[model samples]
Target: MKILIDINHPAHVHYFRHFARIMQSYGHETLFVSRNKEMAQRLLALYNIPYMDRGKGRDSRLGKLMYLIYADYQLFKISAAFNPDLYLNFLHPYPSQVAALLGKPSLVFSDTEHASLHHKLTVPFATKVYTPACYKLDLGQKHVRFNSFMELSYLHPNYFTPNPAILDVLGVQPGEKYAIVRFVSWAAAHDFDHTGMSAANKLKAVQTLAGHAKVFITSEGALPTALEKYRISIPVDKMHDAIYYSSLVFGESATMASEAAVLGTPAIFIDNDGRGYTDEEERKYGLVFNFTESNADQLRAIDKAEAILSDKDAPQKYKHLRETLLADCIDTTQFMVNQALQFSTAHPDPVMPVNS
Candidate 1:
């Protein structure tokens, strides 16, 4: 079987990198095409995943609209040449539409319920939309629910193991305490009103956490001069390497927060929109704590962070919880590979490609 995958984000690379490898190991061919979403290509190179670059995406609404047309034109030409059996992406708009046009099946994976516009634009064109079982919103008849988080596709122990050498990259000595704090720019369409870790709160958290452990701040936007010294300077692909070694993750980005939890590190997620998987990670596994962006709520989160760091047994406790959590989840990369192969064979496209 031949598969064409569209990677639009750095996380998308992680989600499908292992799946792509498994398919190739089985004697199948794969074509990876990616849009420039900050560090996506660099990470792909770090993982040795070969792919075609679609170009860097735009910032303004009008620029994005223009880029869409250019991207689809390029995709059409690429698909005609590759003549793939199936198209796959993390709910990308272009591949789903192009696959439908080519009379081939496209599989889209999604987890964000709040990306309503994205869903409406892409879901109808997709042959099937697979989502996590904990997905809060119903995406109608085409939505097929699975029992695992996208993070499991890569972060599951089956695919990833922490390298202590990465600690040397971060300049951390043995037994030294550290915390990773992430801040998103709130630039995505769904993040219109959703905000987390206000500037005041960010400085406060930094000040409070600095007293306990080395604090490293990863931000998509500008950092205040007061916090300039704390800015993290590590390779893009090494973000998880740092997260795995951290004692705690306090941030607005749920993805990194969840990434921390799955790695046995406790995460305190502060956002107005609490995610389903994060909620379960907090409620069932007790590995994550969620708080809204409010004076009272975020303060409690700070207190919680301090408490977790102060507790000598928190690492062992979270490690046990991670094991319990892992035992319940499936190997997501294997599942994805099976789904792409199954969909291709079960519903073969009769229309031959122009290149064919």
Candidate 2:
């Protein structure tokens, strides 16, 4: 089988790299085409991921519109040449649409059910739209629902193991307490801007938390200079390591916040709209806590963190929850790959190219 995957973000790279490897192992060929977003270059170097760069334009509205147009054109050209047996991607509008137009099977993996303006136009065209049942968006078909989240495939305990070596690389020493803080711009088509935490709120939370643990901050935009006074450390790109060993995680980024919770690192997520798979599923499964921006309820979260930190039995509790969650969820990557391959074989398009 031949597969073409279009990745739009650094998180997508991490999430899909394992899937690409899995496909290759099954005697399939894979090609990745993606936006040259923030972590793209480094990810390519770190993972040896081969990708075609669809460079970003400026950050203005006009620039974004033009970039999308260019990206579509590039995807069309790439798909024409590669003629992939199957098109598998996260939630790409133009790329997936092009694949469908080519009469090829397009499997769109998404956790968001809330239809973005873009999805309103493109989702109906996809052959399969896989989503977590907690997704609030209505895709108007049974194929749109998937019981599993993308995180389960990779972040689940079955596949994920914390790298102590990565801790060493980050210069983290024993007994040095630290908390991970993540902030995202949420510039996607979703109305996620409501989850924005002000600089004052972050400093206030960090000040309170830092009194108990070292604070490490990571954000899509730059951190406030005032945060530097508190000795907050934001590593250039060692986010996974920070989350893996953190005393706790607090964030507005739905994805990373859930990653922390599922990894059994207790997390507090404050979002205007809690719409991600991890946020909805983790809380539903009682593995994590979520707060709306208006509620801003940190009291219970703070108390929970304090208890978890000082208690001798906290790690054991986390371990138990992690194990329980893992047992209940399906491996998302294996399920997605198997389904994609099956779809490809059953509906091969002669006009489409398969890498091998």
Candidate 3:
């Protein structure tokens, strides 16, 4: 079967990279289409996955709304030629719309509940919706729940193993204490009104964490000159390795927090918006801590980080928690590939997500 996969974000590339390869090895052809986001294209190159460039993206709400038609047209033109049996993406509206016009099924993988706008536009046309059980919003019968976070699609033990060599690239030795803190640009539609740490709080958080460990900063927007010196200097694809060996991660990016948790690193998530997967990671597994935009809660995150750093055993404890979390989740990469094939192939395979 021919499958068309849309990669809009860097994380989406990771979400489908492994599944695409496995599909190809089993005699399926996968065509990759991507938006011209900085890191998405870079990481796709790093993964050695070739794709068609759909063009640049917009950060403003008005620009995004205006550009949707052009994006849909571009995708429609491409899908017209590719004639894919199915369309796939990490919860985007474009592919699903194009798939509907072509009378094809679109499988959307999603976990972010705050993205109400995207879901509202895409779900009606989507053939299937795959989301984590922790997701709070119900999308009715078309929704399928898996007891795993979308990050696990690629980061699961079945597909990934951390390489300490990443530390060498960062000019850091193994066992050295360090942390990864992500700052988002708050420019996307869903990001509207949702805020992360303020400039003052960001500076404070950095100063506080610096006293506990070497801090590496990753941000979607520009940093002040004072913080620019701490911007991570390494190949973007090597980020997971950096996260894996880090002592801890605290950030505005819920995806990063969840990634850190599954990698056995203690994580503290802070933002006005909370994600269900990270909530599960915090309450069920004790691998992550969540905080809101309030000053007191944000301060609590700093305190938690200091406490984790002070306790040498914190790493081992989180690692054990990761194991238990893994035991309860499915191998999402395999699950995605099989789900695609089951819909279009010979075996008439009838399967549901393990957790369901």
Clashes of each: 0, 5, 0
Candidate 2 lDDT, 1-356, residue by residue in tens: 77888887777776678788877776678998878777765776678888887776445546667777888788888987888888877776766678777888788877755537557646776888888667777776725665666766577654677766655654567656677777777666564345466666777777777777777777677778877554434443456666777777877767776677667777777765667575664666655667765534544455555555666665567657766666666676667666766665644423322111
Residue 238 CA error for candidate 2 (Å)?
4.7
Per-model TM-score, in order, reads 0.93, 0.87, 0.96
> Which one is best on lDDT?
3
Deviation from native of the Cα of residue 236 in model 1, angstroms:
2.2
Minimum summed lDDT over a 10-residue window in model 1 is located at 347-356
lDDT of 2: 0.68
- Better model by TM-score: candidate 2 vs candidate 3: 3
Task: State, as a TM-score between 0 and 1, how close model 1 is to the true structure.
Answer: 0.93
Lowest lDDT block of 10, candidate 3: 347-356
TM match of model 2 to true structure: 0.87
Position 228, candidate 1: lDDT: 85
Residue 321 of model 2, lDDT score = 75
lDDT of 1 by residue, 1-356 (tens): 78999998888999999888877776778999999877889898898888998988776667767877888888999998999988999976889888888899999999888777678779989989998788898888898987777898889887788889878987889778899988888876668776677779889999999988999999888998999899999888778878888899998988998899889899999888788889989988999999998889989999999998898888789888998888877777877876776665644433221110
The lDDT ranking, best first, is 3, 1, 2
User: What's the CA error at residue 89 for candidate 3, in Å?
Assistant: 0.8
